[model samples]
Every structure is written in structure tokens, then in C-alpha cells.
Target chain A: MRLARVIGTVVATRKEESLIGFKLLVIEEMDPREERPTNNRLVAVDTLGAGEGDVVLWVQGGAARVISEEHRKAPLDVAIVGIIDAVDIADE
Target chain B: MRLARVIGTVVATRKEESLIGFKLLVIEEMDPREERPTNNRLVAVDTLGAGEGDVVLWVQGGAARVISEEHRKAPLDVAIVGIIDAVDIADE
Candidate 1:
């Protein structure tokens, strides 16, 4: 999983039926070290109820369908799975 | 889902039991437009029998757990869900 920070929310009235109750949030990709922002912003399905400015653990791809059985058929590519409490990188 | 190319395979003799039969592959992230390699290479669980040099659609997160009921508890974060036949991008 990659680290991200919830930046904003997305409001889509017309979307896939399976995505009806999911909260979509705009997330900024963060570098593993230092938590710096990198890459493009992505809209992700928030499964952990992450709020704006919260650091989250997000996953991409078909694994996104595992968020819930009801979301199995949703055309979702990304989803926030966890809220990070802390990140400690150990030197190798 | 993001585009990627299977570059190689990974061998983990000691891993989670749920991942016992899954094929682990090294994938190179590609740009959605031209399919050029970008960012970093990631190790993904292949579900569609994608071979080396094949392009695929991959997902990351708990949703990856939805690949199969048996894999619901696997400690996997990334998974290749589909083999891409073609990607057509229309000018917006």
C-alpha cells in the first residue's frame, strides 16, 4: 500500500450503482520517506472513513473491489483502506 | 486500474500461507497514454496468468483481497486483475 493524504471530497450524482454509499475523496500521493507529495492526485473510494488532511493507506486495482462484497462489481480502481497512526522508516 | 508490463517473477519460499499458489510478478508501471515505463517497479500477485512482456491491469489495497475468498486474509497489497488486449485513448 502507498501513503496518501485526503485533500478533498468528490461529489458524483450519477455513477455506478455499486458506488452509491461510498465516499470518494481526492488524495495526494506521498513519498514513502518524509511524507512529501509526489505524482498526480487521485480520487479514491474511502472505506475507512478518512477525512481531509488524514494520512491514509490506499490500494489500487482489482483489490479495490475487496473493500466490500457489495462493491465487488463497482468500476473502482483505487480505495483508501486504512488510516495511518505513524510511520517509522528504519535504515537498512 | 493502472497499466503495467510484467517484467519478471518473484520467488518467496517463505511467505503467508494464503499466497502459497499465487504467482508473484515484478511489474513496471506504465503511463496510461503511451504505455511508457514510469515511477517504480512493483511486485504484484498475478491472477489472470499474465506472462512476461504482457500488459495488465493491476489493483492495490484490501480490494486485492477480493481476488478470491481464500485470499481475503492474505497479506497482499497488489494484484494483477486482467490482461489487457488494447488501450484506446480518445482525445478530450
Candidate 2:
């Protein structure tokens, strides 16, 4: 899982059939080493109901599809699986 | 497919069982909108015969694992699929 902060929401009236009842959000990748957001922004399905400004743990690729069986057959590549409560890293 | 430039090769003597005979490479994402390499540097399994400095197309997720039956059950997240011959874009 990677860290990111939800930046905004995507409002698509029509999208892939598998994404029928999901929330698409804009998220900026969090570089924990640098402790900031990187330029790798992406759209992800919100499965945990994360709100804007919330730091989250996201999964990409095949695991993303596994989150929802319907998604497993879809072309989705990213998904928000958890809302982060905290992050602890050792500099050593 | 996404565009990226192979920066170099990775020398890992020991790795996952599925990647036994594959070459691991370092690639920097090519942000065509900015017309430069972004800070998204990643390590990917090379399926094609791509050399350093070569611009290539990479795939992420389950599609990555589909390249090889051995990789189908592995935890691999990325793979280099093609070495680009050229790219064309028009400014609107």
C-alpha cells in the first residue's frame, strides 16, 4: 500500500460499467521520504469513504480490482483501501 | 501504456522465485505533458530486450503478471513490455 492525500472528487456521469456505484477521486501521491505530495497525481476509486484532505492507503494494479468482484472484471487500476490514521518511519 | 526511459539496470543477485531469469531495470516516468522525466522513478521487470536510454512502454497491475505464467502468481507490480520507436503529439 502507498500513501496519498485525497485532493478532490471526479464527477463522471457515465463511466466503465463496473464502476457503476463508486466514487472516483483525485489523489496526489505522498512521498513519505520527502514528507510531501509528489507530482504523480492519479484517479482512484474510493472504497473506504475517504474525504478530501484525508491521508489514505491506496492499492494499484490487480489488487485494486480484487477490492470489488465487479471491479475484478473492470479495467480499473487504482483504489483507496484504507484511510490512514498515522505513519511512523525511522530515519536510521 | 505509459512512456518511460530506462535509466539503468538493477543488480539483484537474489530475488523472488518468479523473477529468476528476468532483468530488473530502473526507469523514470516520462511526463509527456511536461515533456520531461518526472520524479516517479521505479524498478520494473524487463520482458523485452530494452537497453539503457531506451524509451519504453510499461504496464502496471495484473496485466504485468500475465506476461509470464510464472509471474501470474507473483507479487510483481510493474513490467516493461515494449521499446518505443517514436512518439508523436500535436498541440491543439
Scanning candidate 2 chain A in windows of ten residues, the lowest lDDT window is A83-92
Worst-scoring 10-residue span by lDDT in model 2 chain B: B10-19
Candidate 1 regions exceeding 4 Å error are A1-70, A73-75, A79-92
What is candidate 2's lDDT per residue for B6-62, written digit by digit as tens? 776544333333345766666778976665887776656786888778889998767
Q: Candidate 2, clashing residue pairs? A: none
Q: Estimate, for each residue in A22-91, the C-alpha lDDT of model 1 and write its tens digit.
A: 7667677888787787865666777677887888998876667776777686556788889999999998
DockQ class, candidate 2: incorrect
Go through the candidates in order and give each one's DockQ: 0.07, 0.07
- Residue-level lDDT tens digits of model 2 in A1-92: 35688999889887777678888999998864344987789999885678899877565777566544566777888877556554443222
Query: How does residue B3 of candidate 1 score in lDDT?
Result: 63
Model 1's DockQ score: 0.07
